[model samples]
Target: MKAFQFVEWQRPGEVRDVPVPEPGPGEVLVKVGGAGACHSDLHLLELPAGSRSFAPPFTLGHENAGWVERLGPGATGFEPGDAVIVYGPWGCGLCMNCRQGMENYCQVPGLPSPGGLGGTDGGMAEFLLVPSTRYLIPLGDLDPREAAPLTDAGLTSYHAVKRSVHLLGPGSTAVVIGAGGLGQMAIQVLKALAGATTVVAVDVSADRLQVAEDVGADETLISGDHAVTAIRAITGGLGAELVLDLVGVTSTLTMAAQMARVLGHLTIVGVGTASLPVSFGSPPYECAVASPFWGTIPELIEVIALANSGKIRMLVEHFGLDDAADAYQMLHDGRIRGRAVITPHD
Candidate 1:
């Protein structure tokens, strides 16, 4: 089987022929349909060895969905050909958060992420070995290829937006910073659930903003000197009721703080390792700041529901496993307008 793997620290990942893996007890093997190329993997490659938890020598595709090839001993309920989306972030199943299906927030310490992001071989190959059947969600009517990004890009945005949904009511405003893959999904998630609230998207690239507009953003602004003022002006000087800073750098965080209304919510969703300074009267009065990890299993189900109902869809550019390197390069160069999914079997 040909798999794209991260073989070393600070080096670009490469495609390799690796042996197909078999499922163990309670495990399942999925014939890889599609795998998302996430930005976090780019961040990982830029970091020095040991700076992050996960190591290389593993296939690198966390956002995954495909058909069940076979089930190991003790695995049940799902048939051999059932199409399913994988829930990443494997965790100790007994933790309190895991019990509630929020495995991303599991209490166990130093737990490695599942294949692609950690020690396990991920879906970049023709097949992936899921630790358990519990991590698999039936894709229903959604195509596993287009639906693959719903596992991470879609789920992460859903998690980020779901937190501050209470603040987004009729006549409220919500600003999304960064119109990349996750950010694009965030915009759609807000539209599907945030009801009547105006959605504004901010990105440095005009092309990205155009994509944002095409998707559903009520307003699109370039992130520049006037962005803060523009957001306030659009909000009638009140500022947005909810601000989702998907970029999370110093500049975007500062702008997010400035665009947030009193008693609003500011949620940081990106992995841009920058800090936000906090002080009295900073970020307005009574504003809440939160950073959430990937969403729960239940929220993934909701995102799937939204897709199934035609309320949302992943704008995807397809890549074969052989062109996986080029896909990563395009993602790092910010050339992809929305999500990029690699179809290994194609």
Candidate 2:
């Protein structure tokens, strides 16, 4: 079986042949239907060696959906040939957070994080071995190939928007920074789930901003030094009631802080490592800033339901497993308009 693996730090990932994994006791093996290529994978490879808890030689696709190939002894509730989406975050399943289905914030000690993000083996392979049946969510009528990105890009954006939904009301404004894969979904999610009448999308690329407009952004702005001012103007000087920063760099974070209204919600969902200084008199008055990791299982289910209902649509480009490296290159170069899904059997 061919697998795309991150074998070395600060080096490009490679495709190599590996043995197909069989499901062990209490585990399940899934035939890879599709695996999403995410921007965070580039950040993961840029970090210095030993920066993350999990090492290389692990598969690298976190957003995954596939069919059940086989189930191990005692792995119940699902049968072979069942279509499911792999919940990327693998947790201890015993902690309070995990018990509540927010395993992305698992508090257990000495456990690796989610799959593909410095954790266990992921789905960028011919087959994936899921540790337990708890992580598998029914795909329903959604095509796994088109549904892969929903696990992360869709679910993560849904989680962030759900958090700040209280601030989004009729005539209120919601700002989305970075109109890439997640940003595109965030725009649609805001339209589908929130009451905000005005949704603004910001990005460095005019093409991406156009995509944002296509997805339902009431307005689009070229992100730059004047972005904050434009957002203020759009909100009639009150600033946006809710701002989602999908690009977490210093400049974007600064713009997010400036664009958020006093007492508004600023949610950071990108993996950018830029640090923002916070002290007395810093940031907007009473503005709440939060950085959520990923979505919960329940949230993932909701995201899938939204997709199944056609309320939200995912724009994706398909690539074969052999072209995974090229897909990553396009993602790093910002050439992809939306999410890229790797189809192993394509």
Candidate 3:
């Protein structure tokens, strides 16, 4: 079997022939069909060499969907040849957070955090060995390529929007910054689930803003020349009730804080790294700033259902596993509009 292996930090992944893994007890082996190249993967590759999270010689594609090749002992309720979506985040099952279905927040010590791909052998290979059967969700009638992005890009957006749906009631507003893959999906999720009266999308790229408009943004703004002011203007000076900043840079976070109403919520879903200055002073209103990771297992199921029911369309661009380096380059350059999905079998 051939797999795209990460050989070094800040370097292109190497495509090499490797032994296919067999599932252990309580595990399953999935024949990789489609794997979404996430923006976080770029951060993983860019991690300084020998850093704590920079583990090399491992395959790196976490947002995955494929068919079950074999099920190990104790892996019931699913059989071979069943199409499934791989939930990549795994944690200690006994933790409180994991018990509540929020495995992404598990508090167990020495346990694997919810970060896969870099931490574990992920889905960038012909066949992937899933650690636990619980992480595999069956995708009925959903194409692998279409459903792969929903695992992370769509799920993350859904979770972020779900946190502020109460504030997004009638006559409310939601501003989504950075209209990339996750940002565009956030726009759609806000329109479909939150019932946001007005959806303002901000992005530097005019083409991305246009894509946001096509996907249900009430208005779009270029992230320059007072982007927050434009968002406030669109909201009649009250600012948005829920500001979802998909780009977690200092500039975007500052804009989010400035463009939010009193008692509003600002959710950061992107992994953009930037130092933000904080000072104690008179603030406009009470606002909550939070970073929402990928969603829970049930939310993943719900997202899959929405995609299957034709409620939320999956915007994707297909690429072969050999294009892993090019995919990351396009993502870093912001050249790819939708999620770039890698097909290992292609």
Candidate 4:
């Protein structure tokens, strides 16, 4: 089988030949239907050697969906040929968090997690070996090819939006920063789940802001020095009650805090390493800030349900396995309009 992998640290991943993996006891093997190309993959490639908990030479697709090729012994609840989405974060299944489906916050120490980006092999190849059948969510009637991005891009945004939904109500305002793949879904999730009458989307890209508009943002703004001012003006100087910073950089984090109302919530979901110093005078009084990692398996199920019902849609561009490098290049250059999915069998 041909797989795209991060073969070396601080270098671009390569497409190389590798043997196909078979399902082991209590595991499941899935034929790769689609794999999302995430910005984190690019960031991983830029890190110094040994910086990541997971070493190199592993397939890199975290957002994955596919059909069951085979089920190992004792794998129940799903049969072969079922369409499913692979939950990206694989944690030790025995922890309290994992027992509650919050595997993203797995607490077991000194154990490497599974799945792409988590140290285990991912779904970028012809087939993927899922450690347990529990990580597979039934896709129902959704197309596995187009449904891959729901695993991360959709689930992450949904998790963030779900947490702060209390702040969004009649006459409330919600601001979404970095209107890219995750941000677009965040916009729609806010409109559908949050009762906020005013939904604002901010992004550096005019194209992405346009996508925000198309996906239900009531207002779109080009992110810059003036973004905070524009948001305040739109909100009658009260600022937004909820600010979801999908791009967790210094500027966006600063803007999110400045644009949030007192006692509001600001959730950082992006992977940028920029730091924000919280103090008495930095962010507004009583405002709460938090950084959430990838969502839990239950959230992924809800995201898939939302996608299945057509309330949320993912805009994706397709690429074959051979063209996976070009796909990553396009993502790195900011040319991809939405999420990019690599179709291994195409």
Q: What is the C-alpha lDDT of each candidate?
A: 0.90, 0.90, 0.82, 0.89
Each model's backbone clash number? 0, 0, 0, 0
- Displacement of the residue 223 alpha carbon in candidate 4, Å: 0.9
Q: List where candidate 4 sits over 4 angstroms from the true fold.
A: 110-114
**Residue 29 in candidate 4, Cα distance off native in Å:** 0.2
Worst 10 residues of 2 by lDDT: 275-284
Tens digit per residue, CA lDDT, model 3, 83-172:
999876788877888888777666776444532454677888889888787888889999887788888898888888888888877788
Once fitted onto the true fold, the runs of candidate 3 whose alpha carbons sit more than 4 angstroms away are 110-116, 280-283
Give candidate 1's whole-model lDDT. 0.90
As for candidate 4, its clashing pairs are: none
Residue-by-residue lDDT tens digits, candidate 2, 29-129 = 99989999998899898889999767888888999999999999999999888999988888889999999998888888765377777657789998999
lDDT of 3 at 125: 80
Error of 1 at 82 (Å): 0.8
Instruction: Score every model by TM-score.
Output: 0.98, 0.97, 0.96, 0.98
lDDT of 1 by residue, 133-171 (tens): 889999999999999999999999999998888888789
Between candidates 2 and 4, which one is better according to lDDT? 2
Residue 10, model 4, lDDT: 84
Clashing pairs in 2: none
